[model samples]
Target chain A: MLAFQAGNLGAFQALFAKYQKKIIQFCHRFCGDQAMAEELAQEVFLNIYRGAAGYRPKARFSTWLFQIAVNVCLNEMRKEKYRHRIDSMDASPETESGKPRIKELCDPAPDQNELLEQQEREMMIQKALMGLPEKQRLALSLRVLNGFSYQEIGTQIRCSESAVKTLIHRGRQHLKELLENLYAGGDKS
Target chain B: MTCPYETWISAFMDGELTPQRADAMADHLAGCHGCKAKYEALTGLDQLLQSLPELKPSEQFERTFWKKVADWEENRSRRRLADWFKRGWRTVLAGSLALFILVFVSVFQGRFTRSLSPEEIILAEQMDVLQQYELINNLEILENWEAIAGEDESS
Candidate 1:
């Protein structure tokens, strides 16, 4: 970051190369749309570019980057108004498996059963995530997917450490309940 | 008894409690059915979360993103230059228009003002003549009418 601030394009490129994947994944999980995620990821980098000159070492660079990402995702969510729609759709038991079971049922790809199963699980998880409130989803994703500590999540999410913990706890509990409801017939015992 | 059990259970799960606390929690777990069930659930969640696959970016992500960044930078610079040129042109056009209007008005106001119809000029001149004649007649009548009325009254 210091090198990039010192007008080193290579350093900037290096940072971009290193974090591009992680940023893409984060945005994808947050928005659940690959194309929009990529666009938001680009926006995140652009923000970093615009703000790089004033970059202070107050927090870790990743924290700052993720903070920008979280803001972008939240702003997009607000502008799109898809959260409620997604929540309602996801709340239905049909999309509960992390896979697109409906899609599979309509078009059975016999050779790709494993792939279908994985897709189902991912879909289910994503639907459950969609059901969570934005703040809780952000907190939980930062903690569980990104492996960020509570302090780091707090910094990125602009909340207190205790508040971050509470968000994660509540988020997890919600996920647990949702999953339990969806997979009620499965052996939880 | 201070419930060493509860504290240990939380600490053990978080990996924050001391080894002693962890051991105590482990010991309590062996005897306590309720705490054991809670511990199992937490462990199950932890394992499930850990086992989830890490999502990777698509193959073309880096290339595509950097290309976009470059394009964005180029477009931004170009936009700035274009904006500057636009503002400059607008200022020049505005100044030139203002100057042309000033020169046109200054040179043409007399011609335009003088170009009123003959009837209008004639009307204005007649109005002036009428005003002068009315003023003189009023003065003469004021000077003689009172004397003439006095003579009639004597008669």
Candidate 2:
């Protein structure tokens, strides 16, 4: 980063290469759309470039980068006026058969029926994730998906460590409840 | 034995607890069926999360991103040049004012040193006129001296 700040284009490119996947993944989880995620990821890098001169090593680079990502995603959400909705996860019927045929050709250990079911479950989880309040979703994603430490999550989300833990806990509890409601017909015993 | 176990269980699941605390929580989970059930459920959730597929970027993502970065850098440079131009204009304006003041002072000083007094100027002009009148009178005396001398002797 210092090298980039010193006008090293190669250093900048190296940094971009290092973080592009993780940043895109983070934005994808936030927006639930690959295209929008890419857009947001680009915005995040642009912000880093613009703010590079002022980048003090006050925190780890990942923390600062995630902080910028969170802000960018939140701002994009606000601008687009996105409303959260909860629903049972289902695969798009058009793509499902084609994707599974490709997967089956690659590896045969996983049964196609089981894979489809697992994919639906993941889709449900994604839908549930979307239903979570933005802050909770961000906290949960940072902790669970990104494997950020509590303190690191706090730094990125601008909250205390304990608060980050609480957000994760509350987010998980809410998700568990929502899932139970969706699968209400199943016997708990 | 009565400590709140759920909090420690969560910390344990998150790998946040110290090794000793984690061992204690594991021991408690071994003996307590309720805590064990909760732990199992949480563990299942974690496994489910880990099983979620990683998303891959679409083809041409890199090319598109580099283009955007290039455009952004160009725009930033343009903005910086405009700001510099604005500051340059201000500097030029200030310098021109300073130079104007310096030139005005130099001209004023030169005029102060070489200028004439009003009385001296009027006296010099009167002396020139007096010399001219004496010369004219001498010329008239030369032209009619005998007649003028006879008139003066009679008077």
Candidate 3:
């Protein structure tokens, strides 16, 4: 980072090459949409690279980067348009029936019914994730999906290790109960 | 049934539990069938969640990201330049003010040296404004003072 701050473009290139995919993956988990994740990832890197000159290493660079990533995702979520759209979508009957909002946007063909089942299950998972409180979902995703350590997750989430643990606990418990209920309902149907 | 060690189960899963705490929780799980079931269920949840597929970005993602970094670096340079200019301008203002005071004092001592601390400077300004107002307001009385003095002498 210091090298990049000192006008070394090669250093910046190397850092971007190293972190781009991981950042994109993290963003994907945050927003659950590939295209939007990619856009947010771009913004994350842009902010990091822009602030490199002023970057003092208080925490590990990865922790700082993920912190920025979370902030970007939160910012994107806070936009009035995005929040309003989500509100109306959640209010719609189709979503109220527990169908993932993404499912309503894409329909399955008769021949691809099996594919639809898989997509629906995945979309359901995404919806369950979105249903979680923001901090819980983030902590859970960072630990489970992203494989970050409790310490690292704490640094990223700006909480203590114990708090991160609690978030993960509640998030996992909530998700498990949610999926169990859904599966039970499906079995009866 | 609510298990007291439910959160401990999660902590143990994260490998965050201390040795003594882990053992106590483990003992509870071993003795309590309910907690044991909950533990198994939570472990299953963790396994299933960890099994989520990792999606790889498109090949062009790297290219586009680097492009963004480059564009950001350019903008940063412009902003840095502007910031430097702002700092420079502020320093220039302070330096010129100091130099003006030094030259004025050397050329005319006590003739009206504006050598006042910030607080006194404000008070001096208020007094100056009041004196100017008093002069303007008493102008009509001063103009008629000569005729008034002659009438007093005749009386």
What TM-score would candidate 3 get against the native? Answer: 0.67
Per-candidate DockQ versus the true complex?
A: 0.10, 0.23, 0.27
The runs of at least 3 residues in candidate 3 whose Cα sits more than 4 Å from the true structure, single-residue gaps closed, are A84-117, A185-189, B76-155
Provide TM-scores for the models: 0.63, 0.72, 0.67
lDDT (Cα, tens digit) per residue for candidate 2, span B1-155: 53478767666889888899999998999998888887787777667666667666656678888898889879989999999897889889999999999999999999988767898788678887766877876887788989999999999
| lDDT of every model, 2 decimals | 0.73, 0.77, 0.77
- Tens-digit lDDT track for model 1 on B42-96? 5675566555455555556677777887898899899999998978898889999
Q: In order, what are the TM-scores of chain A for the candidates?
A: 0.82, 0.80, 0.78
The candidate that achieves the highest lDDT relative to the unseen native structure: 3
Give candidate 1 regions above 4 Å deviation. A81-111, A185-189, B1-32, B82-155
Pairs in clash, predicted candidate 1: A97-A124, A98-A120, A98-A121, A98-A122, A98-A123, A98-A124, A99-A119, A99-A120, A99-A121
- lDDT (Cα, tens digit) per residue for candidate 1, span A75-151: 88887454554545545434333544334332344457665566666666766676788898898778767777778
Model 2 superposed RMSD (Cα): 7.9
By TM-score: ranked, best first: 2, 3, 1
Weakest 10 consecutive residues of candidate 2 chain A by summed lDDT = A85-94
How far in Å is the alpha carbon of B11 misplaced in model 3?
A: 0.3
Select the stronger candidate by DockQ from 1 and 3. 3
